[model samples]
Target: MKNIKVKTLGAVLAVLAIANSHANETAEEQGEGMLFRSLFGDTLERTYGITVSGLLDIGFSRNNRSTSDERDDGLSNLPITGLSDEGLELGSLHLFVDKPLKANAIPRVTPLPGPKPETADFGFTIEALYGRNAQFSRTYGWDMGWDMNEEDNAKAKRDRLSFMSVPNLAATAYLPYGPGFTIMAGVFGPIIGYEIPPNIRLAPNPFASRTYAFVSNLTTVSGVLVGTRIMDGPHGLLGIELGIAQGWSNMRDNNDDKALLGALRWRTPDMNTWIDYEFMVGNQENESTRDIQAPTSRLISADGQLRQQHSLNGWHRFSEHWLLGMELVYGHQDGDGKPTTVDIVTGPGFDGAHWWGANAVVTYQIRPDLSFSVRGEHFSDPDGFTLFPTTTARGDFNAITAGFRYDLNHNVSIRPELRYDWFDAIEHDRPFGNGRDRTQLTATVQALVYF
Candidate 1:
């Protein structure tokens, strides 16, 4: 408790300091300083060239089916984190500061964010969140005081629906060689999918409700990553990114195992179409898993087996009013299957686990401030590894969602969505409605107030 208090206090003080970082400068000298004064009053971006933004998301959701039992509430949206519940709750209070490193050597068709380009050689980004969405993104070794432990559970915080989490914090350095190299070190965003992490980005959420595929994808990592633009001519823009990290979501390396991560990207010169292939290969097992693994457990010894994930995602701007995007993900983990959220690790069963999923989305812009989107996805967790790690829950979940985004203004937007889910159970009789029903229907509406 003391540690959490200290961390909270420190964060508050840091934000206060950064808020007043350039207060000494006059509003006249900074054009944006005057513009934003009516809003946030000279934020870091206006004076010191640091981008600061925040979001408050509040919403309500209704699930047509749910369990009456308290052990697990089907309305809580098990196996789903972002919209993981069926009631009106404070989704998240998000804040972030970003100083982007400019790709000085060449200009690209795609747009980057910032008031103006800073030709400086170094930059950094730090993002944090407090609310119901923190449970899944919190890293094992990294979330220290912010994580849900015995004490938190005692308070009946079992939904894992409320807390504080830091998803990404890293410093970037630009090199002058070739098209220019961008080197970054620290915790980095999820690289295995097209959807931006809820905690990593402040605005322009792809959709109010997360897809089945994305929820089962990967999360953050503590590591060092490098990237460079290899092509900037008329043919198009091409780039490559590579990195090394403490396996999966591990914030601090718990063993000798490490993961290799990278991506290959290409985009049309017109910026109308793009695609990327991403991959992460390494061992994943925290101390808890190691302590309770069976004699045959791969991670029990130094020779931990590799956990591999691959993602292929792309999108095309079909026209001024139309766009389409898609993603496919496949991964597997090798283990003795004795792990279940550390400390309480128990039985041993399967030798390996595999999961795969695919999704596609289409969006139409009826106007600038209002748009409509529809998505359909199918995800399978036959081995029960990714979706239900603590129990023998194995199945395939298929869902379709349709939603609309209406921006009342530049700072606030409302999103209403309808989603339908059906399950093909492999281990249990059903996946929803207390494991008695195979289908679940839900409706949700959320509003994002940005500052």
Candidate 2:
């Protein structure tokens, strides 16, 4: 009887070992997954063959200006961006997915036969951001719905210092006919400037802070842009794009009239040098105050803000480790407005406003993972308009930025920047140091990690 009990125990142990082996085999067949995938869903890339990327940015900055300079509740110190009075905060966060395109070769797979003369390809980008930088990135209509009315999380309240914005959600289609034309629809960043936006990972800009000239850029546009290559050869490839948008930086139309925008681009076949001339023109102003009864001057003035801009920018890589880039912008708004902030001047002038600016940058690549960059910019806004929306006291805004880009690895980078801003041509009031000082100096260090 004891021998029979021992045999039974041995048989049970062998059966349990076989069951464990089968369980291991099943787990292997299911593919590798994160330890927490059982709780949270699997990653899109691992489950659906899609590509995903994300970035987290944080920084701390100290400006010469005092905390007394802050305005509008708990956020924003004029002329000082990226590193506002609220330092040591999340600067920007981005998570996106994209499939980029090749303009000329996307249609190469199409056969030349009578019936098979059509092959096509497409791509898309969906990007979103959250942090203090969203203040400058909000697209009207979409984000405006929440931001305009000063909803719960719209403004940078004292309790909540961060906000969110969707800068891009666009798609592109490449056609097979006639050297391959492309059509892009939805919201995208303005195609005029060399500087970067809150979407830092998508751009090669080396600066962590913004230049005064950046105020002239229109931020985002919602509409359709169509393009086709005009020339292709050893000299270069020239292309032209034409678009009609609701207006500058707006996902929803501000007026019934539409804005016309277009660009002409030229570059070397090797892409060593590139140049672009871009323009936008249309009426851009609020129409919510339109008086249906008698024609109010306020309504007429709001409709009269016909806005236009022209931008020319280019870059050339002169050497393996050195490059230079420049951008010039001009803008005009044909309407009347008033200054909300006043210091010394009794009467502010706002008959018409025309603004212009220029930016120049030099970069030296010190190593595969490090670079040094310097940029100088000057912008003039005689009567406000694009410089400061609520104030007609804008002036000749000048700034210089010096910074370094150091990458610790493929997914991590750090930037330390020093910036100085001064108003050479004072309009009505001083903008820094609680309306006391003429210049502002800021220093910042930031880190970025990617996933």
Candidate 3:
């Protein structure tokens, strides 16, 4: 009887082992998803909100002129200014805090009924940046004409390398008043150019270089902007925006005159194409302001001046691996014996000073981790106003850049680029460096790490 009992138990054990084997086989047939889930969380359902982000960028460049002084001081863009002509440089250290508004719903039917309807939402963002790039991020709109000491302190801080600029210290609200309106107020970039300076988290390429057009156009403003979607469907989305604020690049009102800003944004259905039209018009400088200092240069005026700018930009993706972007811009400023920011020259008055430019960029993704890009641009600043070469007038400038981005991983990338610059001379002169050449060449390598 004891032996019989032992045999039955053995049979039961064998049956259970076989069933376990079948279950393992079934799991394998399901593409090892069960094992994957056991190790990593679901990609689609991973939740994220209220995030903190940062970027660290470093680069080295060799300019053809080989002069560390880099004579083209005011002509180059921020961070890439005169200080970065040679050797290794810290590009930018940017940090961002984003708290986007969450969607909430209200009960459609009150007494034990159906779905809930969402109401208007609100959110805010703050950006803190350091390094050479901080110079361009200054905002003057917060100057309330209250305390002179405080204003001086703020100005001093802005000049330092550890500059604190709340570039995006703004509030946003989504009001269902009309066809879904969005109102934003604070300091924001002027929506007039295609080459947007990248914050820490949004750098699209490995190399952190910019076109000449971006360096010359409008940069930032402080004020209120209202926008609404005109059309949104499978075909695409169209939007129009209007804004009023302090004149270009001023945190404080240089004058009582206000600037007007407008934009039209459109995106294709598949989200591969975009077109933008933007403009700004108003008095830019107030020389009569009592607290402000007198104009020290021809580009800055003590007298109030009027300026208007317009830009049209378009971007299209031909495939998963190829893309193209283009921009056209025209701007005019009434120079009142003072040089405008766009053109800082010392000479006769600039009553009808005008500037225009065009830019195009092409990108090809060689692989998921490697990509290449080329950018071409041309800008014209007539009257020897903006593109004033050293002791000469070089009204027209052209540049071309080629670069490649290689991603080390999700958090790190390396970029190498080469650039060539040429000029159309109204007067024979060298504008790029202390060297006596109408053209310049440069090479750079950069690394970006994100957290």
lDDT of each: 0.65, 0.64, 0.59
My TM-score estimates for the predictions, one after another, are 0.81, 0.78, 0.75
TM-score of model 2 relative to the true fold? 0.78
Better of 2 and 3 by TM-score: 2
Give the range of the ten consecutive residues with the poorest summed lDDT in model 3. Answer: 105-114
Tens digit per residue, CA lDDT, model 2, 279-378: 8888765555332111001123334457788988888999899989999989876645455211122233334568999989999988877899999988
> Cα deviation in Å at residue 85, candidate 3?
3.5
Candidate 3 residue-wise lDDT, 335-363, digit = tens = 65534322334433556567889988899
Tell me how many residue pairs clash in candidate 2. 0
Clashes of each: 2, 0, 7
Winner by TM-score: 1
**Candidate no. 3 TM-score:** 0.75
**Top-down TM-score ranking:** 1, 2, 3
lDDT of 1 at 279: 87
Between candidates 1 and 2, the TM-score winner: 1
